[model samples]
Target: MTIKVLVVDDSALIRQLLGEIIRQSPDMQLVGVAQDAYVARDMVNQFAPDVITLDIEMPKVDGLTFLDRLMKARPTPVLMISTLTEAGAEATLRALELGAVDFIAKPKLDVAQGIAEYSQQILDKIRMAATSHVRRARRGESGPPANFVNSGTEKLIAIGASTGGTEAIKEVLRELPANSPAIVITQHMPPGFTTTYAKRLDSICAVSVSEAKDGERVLPGHAYIAPGNLHMHIDKYGADYRISLLDTERVSGHKPSVDVMFNSLAKCAGKNVLAIILTGMGKDGAIGMQAIKAAGGVTLAQDEQSCVVFGMPKEAIRLGAVDSILPLEEISRMALAELNRLGAGTRL
Candidate 1:
């Protein structure tokens, strides 16, 4: 079945360019195109498209506000098209918070040349968005959870994700406590974005969050995000686990892959580790989670209901690598509770 899509942008040129791209893909079909969010809403109600490519800037109702309202009322997969400017990046991040599944950076130069360069990226994002598991926003609910402290010897939590991971990771990390376990995260993203993302998370999360640096000690109450274009792993020397940043080639088609981190944790931390796989577009972490499970470590995957995309976790579950499948809100709590239990003499 062809993936049905709706394109929403104010610029006629962009709409035409995107339409041509969508039409070229054998597995995808452009159900309709809208000039702005108001018209997009009507198209959404009529076409009920599987995916939507939304431009961040529009005339009447801007993409972010429309996306926010759309998610609150009728949640569906949304892929944002944003410029490379700082303002555009900020808007894109806000769209993620509003529940956008993925995004593509708009061209900065010649329209045709830019489209030619980014066409594959745009198509890939749309395909991924079509598979996302978006949820409608609940009325009067507060933003994602706050970080809390962890009191135990386990000391660390490691997470991995891709595709729809940005928003999903934010939702999970935000709930953690001020003194939470030292966390190592590997999210699939380009170089410039991960630093911004880490900083963004740090501001919202009570714990100290920063991009991982080589040989940095994994201290409790802090989180280290693997930098883009590098693989991050954990290494143990005596009682301390330190971050190891690698310039090695990409594994599983992702530079900062979940498999790299999970494998490292299995070898170094072993029984002392907790690995959680959240929403993503592919199977990067499945085998690594299996390795962790086999080494007497605890593993969890986000369940389909709360996942923006069920690809990674589903793949892990299929491999029998996951010990539990919890919703987004429950993952952090479950991790903490399991750590507390294991630290209290309950073995996996």
Candidate 2:
């Protein structure tokens, strides 16, 4: 099946670069290229593309506004092309919340030679976006249940996700109470984006959130996100767990790999961990989740119906590593419940 793709950008160079890349792929067809939002809208209505590569900064109408309108009406899978800057990170995250499947940092076009380096990565993102489920804009919901109470177990919660993870992670975090257990997360993002992402979560979530600093103590009621381009793991120091960041080779094809984080928890936190594998595009977390299960830690996975791309969780479930398969909306509630159960049963 050939994927029909539309390229939307204000720059002719970007359109040409992306169009060339798409045309070179045997499995893809360059259906159309639009230089602006108005043209893109017309092209979308005419071609009904299977996927779209959209630039965040555009003339007349910005990418976020266009994306929101598209999702509410047409609902096509989109991959945002974003610059690697703080402002770009913020817009890209908003695009995800509005329903983009994934994003790639725009190649440094000034150094035209560097653009070729991103060709394969851009192709891979398009392929994933072509197959991803495009969810509609969800209505705003209230916070965590008022009756909810944390176990205060001091148990650590580890979460791993990719692809459509940004919004999925936000949904889970928003459901956790202020006193919930400490959480460490890896959400497959480029370097400049995770800082903005952490700050965004901290603003809306009850629990404090920040990008994990090396050797920092992992405390209850706070969430730590692994920095982009680095692998993050927990190390046991005396009686407490501390964050450890490593400039290591890509594990399972990703820096800040979920497997690395999960494996470390299996060794350091042992039964005092509750690990979750969420929506993603690969089998990265399965092996480590299995190790966690073997170490007596509880594991949960997002269910296929709720996942944007049910790859990682499906793999974990296949390995017999997951204790429960749940919807995205239910994960936080369940995590809190499990923490309470573990708290009642064990001290460490």
| Among all candidates shown, the one with the greatest lDDT | 2
**In candidate 2, what residue range of length 10 has the lowest lDDT sum?**
145-154
RMSD of each: 3.4, 1.6
Clash counts for the predictions, in order: 9, 0
User: What TM-score against the true fold does each predicted structure earn?
Assistant: 0.87, 0.96
Misplaced by over 4 Å in model 1 are: 108-117, 137-154, 344-348
* Residue 82 accuracy (lDDT) in model 2: 91
List candidate 2 segments past 4 Å from native: 112-116, 146-153, 344-348
Report model 1's TM-score to 2 decimal places.
0.87
For residues 47-133, could you state the per-residue lDDT of candidate 2 as single tens digits? Answer: 999999999999999998999999988999999999889999999988888999999888776786766668989998899888888
Tens digits of per-residue lDDT for model 1, 52-131: 99998899899989999888788889988887655776788778878888888765546455566588888888888887
lDDT of 1: 0.84
